[model samples]
Target: MDGYVMRLNQFISHNAKYSRREADILIEQGRVNIEKTKANTKSVLLEGQRVFIDGKYVKPKDEELYTVIVYHKPKGELVSKKDDRGRRVVYDTLGGKYMHFVPIGRLDFASEGVLLLTDNKKVAQSLMESDLEREYIIKINGKITEEMIRAMNEGIHIENASTGAHQKSKIYSMTFAPFIRYEIGKNDIHFSKLKVTIMEGKNRELRRFFAHFKADVMDLRRIRYGWINLNALPVGKIRFLNKDEYKQLHQFMGKIGKIDSFISKNNI
Candidate 1:
């Protein structure tokens, strides 16, 4: 109790009641208290301190061992807990006590492949914040020209429809190497397969990036995230990361600050 202290919002987040942002709002609204005193966003709680939100006691949960799982998400299922349209979701395919686990990022309903899930928010945050690369194999419906490949690598600007104004958003701003792995040639039809790698995970970035080139994505599947590869995992199956895998992930995160080559190898 005397040796440990944590920020009020972090304490609330660790309790799994609300996110840090939500905790801040509750604190600002005068709904949170520590030791019978009103708590602020920056207030620090000593170990064993009692916390109450809206007049209800909230005990800090004992630290649980972090659990990380690699899920082969199937297409047509969402990466959400529930869908309003009653469509099947990724969570529906999962069994046991995985209700608390959160997907690190997400694969869209139409796209599928390797997805990382974890019960520990810190682990999720760390891996996401790191400059780890993700690889995808995409089938595109168009003749991919060398000029288009050059433009994609240099970066392209697309209209930001969500911004209301005629603002433009930049994509592929980082170093991206795309290789044409397969191609189906016909007199009047063209279909090409590409293996693209990127470090950022913007929303539907790959699809949008191809759309800028007037190329339609027929299918998209993520094959790798960091050192973890989908490999031979069957669709809709989840595998818990082993101790060595977990250790390597953390080690990879540490080395991202020094060298990128460290991550290219040791992806378990």
Candidate 2:
């Protein structure tokens, strides 16, 4: 029970599919159940419980060797498991079989950035749960004020509510305060091109932040996340983590558990 586990509802949220409340509605309609019991909407899930949703057996995804891929997703590509409209997908560019992985976090279809895709559910869950930092290179038209920085760093009240109850739209982790670190000279005027960092991976949070200030995001890109950086990966291209980089990621997670030991012993 010490390892990765989540309630039936939380499992849905973690999958990036739907919210917990929505999961509950599915449960109430007898669409989901834990073991053989009708799911208690608020019941806590212990490790190693067999679950089912809509007659499909639920299992935490498992793939070979905790693979992590850094995808330089270009704009207009969807980050979904499958695109209904048959538009270009990130996986389509990956080519061949990749063991059906899921993205660790998301970037809007219109935004371009570094996105993490992996088949290791635990690794994905830990990255979302841990206090690891994320860095972004944001380009916006107009000036950024001190108060705006303060609000971005301290957390912004997203114009609309999110899946969770926290009114302080968790677009950022407490580890980072929003600040503009750089400004490039454009036609003798100091324009804003800021490098910001945070941990929370809220959907469309970047666009929402600038929206609150009436500023338009000319371009937004996630350059780094925790120990990994998308230094030279070309847009729409991806590469798997070498053994050393994979080990380094485990170390950066603060020596959490036997995942490190397992990786070391197996050389994965």
Candidate 3:
């Protein structure tokens, strides 16, 4: 009974995986609610009360400020927060205060690209949703045929059935068209490059898809996640995002930001 009410933006900043400014926007957009009442920027409440945003309940996180960082995950480094084998972790290579951030999504030991690290659980969960398109560039051995490309475009049926041949198959839809479809270009006679976009980030899905045709993947890299792109970023360097970029991402997801100047003021 002694807790004091806090501003909607502050509440969201504490509970959700967004910045204070982003939380303010969400408040203004009426995505937040308290006990079924729509929330405004000035709305406030004490602790231990029910609050919801984007149809999901919100609560204070153990950690403050949901931070997102993009790391140029190098091959051979484990993507896990901690590995029992005592091998080097991607976070270790960061060697900064941001090293404690959790990766938004997974990148296998051999694959590398713009991997996202964030303390914001909600943002991480949102990015992992299958609705968000993630793009990757894959280099592989063996010439890909037109028929194979057609199959990829149409979506390949991955069967995990352990029974009779007449059993129904599970159809996974293709989210985006291949950049360099089936045609074997003039680059290499036997090897080819392809850019594929996937909404579902299934484990080793890309490798398995190519393995069906006996193609060996030489390299794999994630180039984009949602509207965020990795442009000319060095292999082992990461760039902190600016305010506008963060704002656009929240807006795209129907979320809003309140403190518009948080990024500009902080010069992040």
TM-score of each: 0.67, 0.62, 0.62
In model 1, where do residues sit more than 4 Å from their true spots?
A: 1-47, 50-64, 160-188, 253-268
lDDT of 2 by residue, 200-243 (tens): 64656666666556666778888887778889988888888878
lDDT agreement of model 1 with the native: 0.73
Shift of residue 39 alpha carbon in model 2, Å:
20
Higher-lDDT candidate of 1 and 3: 1
Clashing pairs in 1: 227-267
* Per-residue accuracy of model 1 over 237-260 as CA lDDT, tens digit each: 988777778789767655653455
Per-candidate local distance difference test: 0.73, 0.68, 0.68
Q: Using lDDT as the measure, what is the rank order of every candidate, best first?
A: 1, 2, 3
Q: How many backbone clashes does candidate 1 have?
A: 1
Kindly report which residue stretches of model 3 are placed more than 4 angstroms away from their true locations once superposed: 1-65, 160-189, 253-268
- Native-referenced Cα lDDT, model 3: 0.68
Candidate 3's TM-score reads: 0.62
> Residue 89, candidate 3: how far off, in angstroms?
1.3
